[model samples]
Target: MDDMKKLLEEIEKLKKEIEELKGEKEKKEFMESEKIIEVIDKIEEIVKKGFSVIEGAVIGSLEGIKRSLQEKENGR
Candidate 1:
């Protein structure tokens, strides 16, 4: 969970970097723009993986809780 949180934080940092680069883009060269695009792609990949992991974790926890509740109801 903590790792997933860190990955999300990294995505935020990447977004900020892109924004900063855009502000200075007119003064920069074409290669810099290409680099920004590459970073954006990489960030997209990381965000996808991070969200999937977090989603799986949350679903699994919910299932566990549901099972526990069912078992208690059965016991009663």
Candidate 2:
């Protein structure tokens, strides 16, 4: 009878420990996912800014070319 009681106590202790471990794992995973999302958001912002700069440069170049062609025709 004493052995059975001891066995039950041990099982209860083990269950609590397992529950703690599972809680810690879930917390860690949530933290890691948050960091990953932050990094992805930063990357997206940088990409959008880079494309905007490229677009501006392309438009400026086209405008310059058009002006130069108009001046040449005026000269002729």
Candidate 3:
């Protein structure tokens, strides 16, 4: 009966340790996920700004070319 009691105590201690480790793992995973989401949001913002700049440049270039062509035709 003494031996059985000792074994039960050991098992309970192990179960508590396992629970603590599981909680730590969950916290770590949540932090990593939050970091990933932050990075993704930043990347999306940068991409949107880059695309807007590119579109503006293209439109300005096209307008300049059209104006030049018109001036040349008028001269001819």
Residue-level lDDT tens digits of model 3 in 1-76: 9999999999999999999999999999999999999999999999999999999999999999999999999999
Q: Superposing every Cα of model 1 onto the true structure, what RMSD results?
A: 23.8
Best-to-worst TM-score order: 2, 3, 1
Model 2 clash count equals 0
Q: Point out where model 2 deviates above 4 Å.
A: none
> Which parts of model 3 have CA positions greater than 4 angstroms off?
74-76
- Cα shift from native, residue 19, model 1 (Å): 30
Model 1 agreement with the true structure over 1-76: per-residue lDDT tens digits: 9999999999999999999988778657677888999999999999999999999999999999999999999999
Candidates 1 and 2, the one with greater lDDT: 2
Please report, as a residue range, the 10-residue window in candidate 3 with the lowest summed lDDT. 51-60
Residue pairs in candidate 3 whose N, alpha carbon or C atoms collide under 3 angstroms: none
| lDDT of predicted model 2 | 1.00
Question: What is the C-alpha local distance difference test score of each model?
Answer: 0.95, 1.00, 1.00
* Pairs of residues clashing in candidate 1: none
Residue pairs clashing in model 2 are none
Relative to the true structure, candidate 3 reaches a TM of 0.81
Winning model by TM-score: 2
